[model samples]
Target: MPSVVKWSHYALLAGFSAVLPVAAYAQTEVEAEAEPEAATTVTDERVVLEADIVYENSADNTIIAEGNVEALHQGRVLRADRLIYDRTTERARASGNVIITEADGSQQFAEEVDVGPDLTDGYAIGYSARLPGDATVAAKSAIRRSDGINALEHVVYTACPLCEEDTTPTWSIRARRAVLDEESQMISYRDAVIEIGGVPVFYLPYLSHPDPNSERRSGLLMPNAGLSSTLGAFYKQPYYWAVSDHSDITISPMVMQNVNPLLGVDFRKRFYSGAVKFETSFTHEADFDSDGETFGEETFRGHLYGNGLFAISPEWKWGFGVETQTDDLYDRRYDISGQGDKRGLYSNQPRRLLSQVFVTGQGDSYYTDAALLNFQGLRGEDDAARLPLVSPLAYADKYWDLGAYGFASVTASTAILTREVGADSHRASLGGDWNTMKILPGGFTFEPFAELRGDYYMLDEDVSGKDSVARAVGNTGAKLAYPMVRPGTNVDLMLEPAVMAAWGFSNVNDPAIPVEDSLLYEFDESSLFEANGFGNFDLYEGDGKVSAGLTARALWKNGTEVSTTVGRRWRSRADPAFDVASNLDGKSSDWLASASLKMGKKLELSSRVRLDEKDLSLSRFDMRAATSFDWFRAVGQYYKIDERISPAGTSDEGIFLRGEIQFTDRYSVVFGQLRDISRNVNTRQEIGIAYTDDCSRFELLYNRSELRDRTLGPTESFQVRFSLLSLGNFGSDSFE
Candidate 1:
């Protein structure tokens, strides 16, 4: 017999329900948050009561409700089979199937409940609470104080659910008494025991956890422990401090049996328009190799990384990134993997880290980016003095669509580069292009394009090129293509034949100019017809050339697709700017061939290769394949190049393989390998096993790396991680 007043569920339970997190993963917060203030707050809200059978004694100022009794206050609801209220004392008592539903959707059950003055002091017998994230807390009796404190007798807490046939939970904490402090917002347990598989394994006289409402409270985070050959047995613990509602910081200390302790700090904050984060770590120790052999004088070694971005206006923004290290081998030796992140900044490579400050702007048909970048090389032979500092590398582009006349685009760019031990240079350039395409009656397409560019440069006297130089260049070209299609009931096939011709004037590619950015170049079918295959402004093609290519695509009703392209370029006058290893140096460029196949989301294969014009032998090759099935999935990659053609001017070949297999719904295994085929060495290998379910996860992994840089040699490592849903994660790792 339930009849309730009109209400909003969220509004009613807003007060107490807001503290659900304090009760769910309540065991982890005790050390993090400060003691709550004793001050009390008052809300202007009233309680509503309803029941099927109601009786009142006016003389005694009392009311009684039987059968489906209900009381609602500020979204916290209490339901019982019988309830009695004393108006004079402002007290209430309820019995039989009592339930208390909190504002945040948590629920408590009891056989008897009693309320004290102003309905603020509530206590129950036979108490059990179901918190968010499927967590549960049970006790023989419990008391809820209006001052935000809770006390319980004979308590049991667990996040794992019990099996239908097995009454015991997978893990649980049992205590003789538990109290949640109103001031500290922490839970303290007396005579507590941790149980696994229904068997008690550990005991403590006293234990505590903190729980803060509406804000992240300070606390101890998950810790790491592991045994390693290099660092010996080690343990790393971190403490979190919630500086304010918008910012926080974490301090971690790593102690090892062999090496000196290391200290690290991480801070993060947010503002109205953006956010920023920084992490830094420091340690004092002599240099050591992978085998834990120490050398050199001991000193302070550390690293710092940071990133931030803010909006200047709706169309403009500014940001900065910082990634610096005191030494080259500190990260690999200490396992500090990620350097940092800076938005809008490009990373140089894995061997080097790049930091930059940048400003960017964007609008319809226009875009621009400018950055000041500094490079830090991680390799042993890298010299800081040789690294360049790029100041104000900027580019801007604007495009216009001219109906019937064609599309036109204008671009401007500038760069200033300086190095401690190398040549310094500055450059400015402006360019424009216009093009239009027309489709003829026979499904043949024709496109004509024109381009012009000019550049002014200033260089250091030490450079071979020139102290200053100026150059202007232009090219005009047209492309022709015809498509032939064959459409069938079950399949579709299309073939396109294309040809391009272009003439260039004003050759500006001078050896004296010093190659600044176009040191790395590769020609593929995608750029086979481009008048200037060089990716940067420092080089240009200034002669007549013709390119021809054929493209084929097939689609099947079964959802399979395949595409292929084959092309080559013939230059009337070979560009001297290209090196012999670049394949584009000769009048007739190497044949470029590429193909791709995708099969209904389950399989994919792609390959691109360059063939020598003399014998059609493979000059360069890159291939990749991936496949997925119900039980297993795998991906493979292969790359090869002549040493002379590579960016490092060294022949290289490599292969990488990774795969995962699911043997059961809850168990899986993962494996990976990266090998340098040319050097006949294994760079890395990984093997791991994992178990997962709705509420928990566990993993164990083995990793091996053979990279030998400086004093660091090959090593093998083992790591394990475990987590409970809604709670926290903890892990340990070690190397030998």
Candidate 2:
């Protein structure tokens, strides 16, 4: 049987307060940590008092309890060496090691306390309180009134832990007089002085903040200040408005020394089933170069980005995203980021952004998706007419379980692509596939699969040929693999040899149907044995081919692993649809090899390479490495491509590396670099030093960037940021 229980039931029993105080304290701690709604009124439950001696004087209507007195009511508890209650005045007082723990888990410790019969109002000497999240308040003395206000003298507040040897905390706030308003759950200090490293830094007449138990309250947030080569000295102050329980907005206005002021706004709202968020910024200024030199005509420049997702049903949902800008260099010049990081928003390249609306649904054995997509180019050389807009791109797939026999599945896809200056096209495709797997003797596996697909295309203009085009594609294949495992005391080894032979219709590539999604096809180890390597309806691998691969892996007992795979494909006839640089143009494809190594989680290295089959020369390679040392951690990636068969000036070689060197427990240095090896230029470089303590953090950063856009050319910046606990935080967009 299952039983339900609550700790309050146990708290109602006699003499149980001492045994359950710890449990009750834990419950309140969790509630405080979550910062739930504040309880305004005390519970009316009867107070259960336990003590060694209890006496009542009817004549004076006074009750006295001594010798380890304890009073419990719900989760709240009061403990002291002695307690006195005046029935006539409805007041209760305690002395000698008095401790009062509220229902919200806040604790107060004092030598003596006097209050009403209900203990709601009190006066205490040597008072100190511990709030949630390491925040504390101490005072020489305090007075509490029935109005739920506390007035304290000689108050000290801090969220940092104190060291016994040093005594001083990382940071502290000292005030001559402090007022705590329980009704508003706020603390206000008068004649306060801020101290850092035990040295007075700033003085304030008045300061107020929530009692660490409230969040999302409306107030002026922290300010961001920086100096940039483009914008010069800039400072932004942001104010947050808690419009309602379900919505909020932040308005940030930035003033710059070199240009006109800019305003940034962010709004968010939550619904029962979903949420929406948007951010935008606007500025009016003349065109400016990287040197902050103004030119051309003055104009309004800004950018708007937004995303939203909502649920329609249990198995269906829809979402939309949008990104737009008046010019190419606005975001970079203003240091804006966090765009294209939402659902339905896709950014394929560094300077290109995609806005989309999509609907998706899934069932036990079926899936479907439909989307409408648009593109925005942020590159200086981008031609808007050449961009593509795809509407009603849809796909659906369903499969059935065949148990003993071969399984079967059906898939359908359709797309409509339109461009301002290029041809408009529409394509629909339907395919059926059947496959099955069998385990044979000696740990051998064999599989057979067959697929037939038909695609119809309609073009508004000529596409190599004229008008509509239709093609029927079919492929049948059989794959065989033998995998073996050898377990040893020190290492475990595994090897697998796989081969596939597929016969399909040749010369099925129709020139009248243009390729959209399969323009950059590259055969690699991951697709070594696949019958069809192309991903779109227009281009399908329809020639007979044989592919083979060998994979080997070793795992050591000390959490080390190494793996390698090598594969190649042989085609009966050359496929003209693939370019030479793709490694799949000739009768024999390039040798595709990949290797990986992992020395536990702190280190990893992986590489993939393609070698020309004719000369056995390196064609292209991408390598990545990551490692963590005692004082440093770094990750690096490098890639190079052969220039012989690539587009003019497009063959590329580059490396990007970034990491942090932890020199101490509280300090570290971070750096990153992106170098264009072929061009002998550093595209981006950054270095920063960071420091953190229990109550504060400080950072200093420097960055340099060199880009192709004339308006966004070489620039450098240095930034500084610092934050303190309970005093809000301040930061800006990263240079990267």
Q: List runs of model 2 lying over 4 Å from the truth.
A: 1-88, 93-107, 130-135, 140-143, 150-154, 175-194, 200-211, 340-342, 345-347, 462-465, 557-559, 628-630, 645-648, 723-728, 732-736
* Model 2 residue 98 distance off true place after TM-score fit, in angstroms: 4.9
Count backbone overlaps in model 2.
Answer: 3
| Weakest ten-residue segment in model 2 by summed lDDT | 1-10
* Candidate 1 runs further than 4 Å off: 1-82, 97-107, 117-119, 131-133, 173-196, 199-213, 340-343, 483-494, 554-561, 598-601, 625-630, 633-636, 648-650, 732-736
TM-score of 1: 0.85
lDDT of each: 0.76, 0.76
Candidate 1 residue-wise lDDT at 601: 50
Candidate 2, residues 1-736, lDDT tens digits: the string is 0000111111112112322332223223334435544311212333566779776667886677789877776676788888766656766567788776767776667777666533346577777766555666677877766786767778777777665686787777788887766676566778998787789977878766544444456666666877888889988988888898999999999999898899999999999988998899998888888878889888888988888989999999898888888887787878789644654734455778778898989999999999998888887678888788999789999999999987999999999999888777899999999999999988899999999999888886554455788888989998999999999999999999999999999888877677787766676888888898665576788788999999999999999999999999999899888778656787888899999999965899999999888898888899999988867788999999888556553678999999888889989898899999988878898899977788777778888887657666788878776677767565753322
lDDT for position 705 in model 1: 85
